[model samples]
Target: MTTHCDFGASLNDYLRDRLVSGIRSESAKQKLLSEASLTFEQATKIVLSMEQAEKSAAALSIGRPERIHQMSSVVARRGRFDNGAQHSKTHSQTARSDNAGAAWRGAGGTAKV
Candidate 1:
């Protein structure tokens, strides 16, 4: 004998499993479910607002002109380093040093006076 499953129920169960695994915050999960119940326009506006807030925060954190330029330069340098290592003959050494540098930077780099 073969068992049959309800597709709608199966889909809902799959979505619930993904939500539980992907979202660490109970409040966020509930908010997502509630938003899913909204009309398309309302949901679109809510998502846009959330995205705008995130963009604003990122812009604020990166701060003023000079600092923003410096941050961009650092990001560019890291990207070049990453790309160069991808093409280098001694890729393992470069990768190891990159990991060590990241750890050291995270530890505050032995602060010099």
Candidate 2:
């Protein structure tokens, strides 16, 4: 037969260890207790939920599809901008002409004759 004894260390030590191990933060634990008014078991469940979410996100990014898509989109958009600059020159001339008309109207329709 064996007897079990509770460790004399404060609960904070356990919480710090869990947080440092990427399980949950001390602030999060406190928020669960104070803000959420959750019991210890409920707080543990919340912490586990957060941990699972983090794991799931990490798993999703392991393939790096999102990062690859972002990089490709950036490259494609840059290419489009470079190609569109030539087209933009003509459009800008038309825009300036429109702006001049607007300015003429704003100046009480007095033509620059």
Residue 48 CA displacement from its true place in model 1, Å: 0.4
Against the unseen true structure, what C-alpha lDDT does each candidate score?
0.62, 0.64
- lDDT string for model 1 (1-113, tens) is 11365565355556454544575556544555675454435544555566677789888877487887888998887884464455644888888777888887877995222
Q: Pick by lDDT: which candidate is best?
A: 2
lDDT of 1 at 90: 87
Q: Enumerate residue pairs that collide in model 2.
A: none
Return the TM-score for each candidate structure: 0.29, 0.45
lDDT of 2 by residue, 1-113 (tens): 11264645545455544543563466555556464334445656677886788789898889698889998898787874474454535887889888889888888997452
- Identify the runs in model 2 with alpha carbons over 4 angstroms from their true place: 1-36, 65-86, 91-113
**Candidate 1 TM-score, true structure as reference:** 0.29
In candidate 1, the residue pairs with backbone N, CA or C atoms under 3 Å apart (3 or more residues apart, or in different chains) clash, namely none
lDDT of 2: 0.64
lDDT, candidate 2, residue 3? Answer: 25
